[model samples]
Target: MAWQTYDPTIEDAYRKQLIVDDRMCFVEVIDTAGQEEYATLRDQWVREGQGFILVYSIASRATFERLEVFRQAMLKVKRQKPVFMLVGNKRDKQYEREVSTAEGAAKAREFNCQFLETSAKTSENVEHLFKTLVRLLRATKQQEQGVQGPIRSPEKEKKGRKCIIM
Candidate 1:
C-alpha cells in the first residue's frame, strides 16, 4: 500500500480521483464546516465499499469537535460497510496541542475504530498510520467472512451455487 495526499483546494476533483486498493490512501484536507456535502460524499463512498480515515488536527479543539459531527454524518449513510480510522494529525506540535493523544484514542475507541497520531511535516508516524489502517481493513474483511464459509465471487454467484472458500 502506498500513501498519497489529497489536495484541499479542489474538492470534487480530488475526491473523484480517490481509489480503493489493498493499500492505504492518505487524504489531507481541512475540516468541513457543513455536513450536507460531506454526507453525500460519505454515502457515495459507502456505496462504493471504500474505507475512510477521518483526520483532525490535534492543535485545534474546533477541529476535534467537528470530527464528532463528521462521524455522525457518516453514520447517516450506515456504518457496517465502510470501515473508518480516526487520525489525530499534527502530532509533532505536541506543545500546541489542544487535544491529548489519550483523548483522541478514547474517542476512537468509543466509536469502534482505530486511532493514531501523525505528522505530515516531520513525517512522524505518517507511514505507520496508513499502514495500520490498511492492515486493519484487511483483517476486518477477513473476519467478516467467518471461520468456515464458502467464498463466492459476486459476479459468479448469479448463475448458480458457485462458491469457493479460501
Candidate 2:
C-alpha cells in the first residue's frame, strides 16, 4: 500500500479495485507529487478520472500553499469540475504539523471539496477518504443521469483515464 517514493520528479500511476457497498470500485491513483514537469500527463489523468483525492502533507507548508494552484489547474483543464476531496496526510506527525486543522478546513471550504485528515503511515481515515470519494462519484453520476441520462460527449472521450467501477 506504500507506493511513495523519495524522488519528486518520479510519478506513479496505480489502479486498485475495491468492493464498496457490494459493488466494484476501480480507483486510479496518479501521484503527481513534485511532477509539475509532467503537466501534459497529469492533465490527461485528470480528464479521465471520475473522482480525485488531492493530498498534501500537514507538515509541508509549500504543499498546502500549492493546493489551490493544483485545483485551479484541474478546473482549467476539465470542462466540468470533477468530484475531488482534500486530504491532509501525515496526521500522525503532530509534532511537525505546519498547517493547522482550521487552515486545512478553511482551504477545503474555499475549494468546495470534502476534507479529511489522515495518517497514511498509521492508516487513519484512509478507508474513509476513499469511501467518501466513491460516494461522491456515485452521486455525481446519478445527478448527471437525472439530467436526461448522462450528459456525455463521446468526442471528449478521446483520451482520458477510465475508472471501471462495476
Candidate 3:
C-alpha cells in the first residue's frame, strides 16, 4: 500500500492473525511475485504451504498468462489438487485493464477455485479474499479429519505450516 508504483518483489513475508468463522487463524503470507530467480525454490515453498493465492495484475496480460505456469508448478509439487484462489489485482485501474473480470472468472472456473478482483490502493476485497481462503482451508482440514475417523490429541497434533501466495 505504500508503494507508489509496482515494485518487483523478490520475496516478502507477512504475519497476520485473523478471526474467521469464529475461529482464530494465524496466517503467514509469503509473496514472491513469481520471479524467475526463485524458481528453483518454488517446490519447497509449495510443499510447506497449506493454501495458495495466485495473483495477477488486471492491467497486465503478461502477468495473467503466467498464472498457468505457477499453477502447474504447484500441482506438480503437491502431487494432488491443492486449494487455490485466483485474484485479479489492480481493479482500480479499469481504464488500463487488459484482462476482463469474465476472463478472470473463467480462469478460476478452469482451476476449480474461487475468484475475485481487488484494488490494493483502495483496500477493496483484500480482507475478504483472505477470509474466504481461510474458510476454504478450514473446510478442507475438517473434511480430512472426518475421513481420518477421529481427532488426535494435542500431543499428537501435526506441525503447522504457512499459507503462501505468488
Candidate 4:
C-alpha cells in the first residue's frame, strides 16, 4: 500500500508484519532521490534490511543508473549477499519512458535479482513485486531443510515418500 506523509522520515524507515509466508519480512523500500545527506543512515538500514526492493523511475534514466550504486553499497555494508528485487516504476507514463523493460531486466540479470515493471498510479505488478521477494527469501531459508528431512521409523515409511531412516 502506498502512503503519503507530511511527517518527514530522515532515516528511510520500515514497517513490517507477518505475511502469508508466516515470516516477519523486513523489507526496505528505498528512495535515493533525496538521500545524498543520509549516507550514515543508509548504512544502518542496509545492515538490518535483510531484503530490499530497489525502485527506479522508468521516467528517469538517472534513477535507473543510480540503482546499481545503491545495490552495490547494500551488498558491501551487509558483508554478504542479500535478497533483492529491482522494480521499474511509473509504467503508466509510457510516453515519458526513458528506460526500456529489457534494460531493467538485463540489469537485474547482471545482479541476479528479480525484476518487474510497476505503475503506482495504476497499481500494476506492484503487489507481485513484493510477493515475489517474500517467496524468494522463504524459499532460500527452506533449502537448508530439503537436504535433511525429519527422520522416521522404517516400519512407518511410505513407499513413494521414503522417510529418512534414523
lDDT of each: 0.62, 0.75, 0.82, 0.68
Task: Let me know the TM-score candidate 3 reaches against the reference structure.
Answer: 0.87
Candidate 4 is scored at a TM of: 0.72
Candidate 1 residue-wise lDDT, 1-166, digit = tens: 2334633332342221123354324333223333465656646654444456778889999888888776676667765655778888887788999999999999999888889888766667766665565566657657776864545677754443211110
lDDT of 3 at 137: 84
* CA-RMSD of model 4: 9.4
Model 3 Cα lDDT, one tens digit per residue, 1-166: 2322344456877787778878776788778878878777778878878789999999999999999999998899986568999999999999999999999999999999999998867777888988899989878878988989656665555444334544
Query: How should the candidates be ordered by TM-score, best one leading?
Result: 3, 2, 4, 1
State in Å the error of residue 139, model 1.
Answer: 1.1
lDDT (tens digit, per residue) of candidate 4 on 35-151:
768788778767755567788889999999998788778788986567888889889899999999999999999989889998867778865766677787657545634756634
Model 3 CA lDDT for position 37: 83
Q: Give the lowest summed-lDDT range of ten residues in model 4.
A: 157-166
Best candidate, TM-score: 3
The best candidate in terms of lDDT: 3
Sort the predicted structures by lDDT, highest score first.
3, 2, 4, 1
Candidate 4 overall lDDT versus native = 0.68
For every candidate, C-alpha RMSD to the true structure in Å:
7.1, 4.7, 3.1, 9.4
State the weakest 10-residue window (summed lDDT) of model 2. Answer: 157-166
Give Cα distance to truth, residue 62, candidate 2, Å. Answer: 1.3
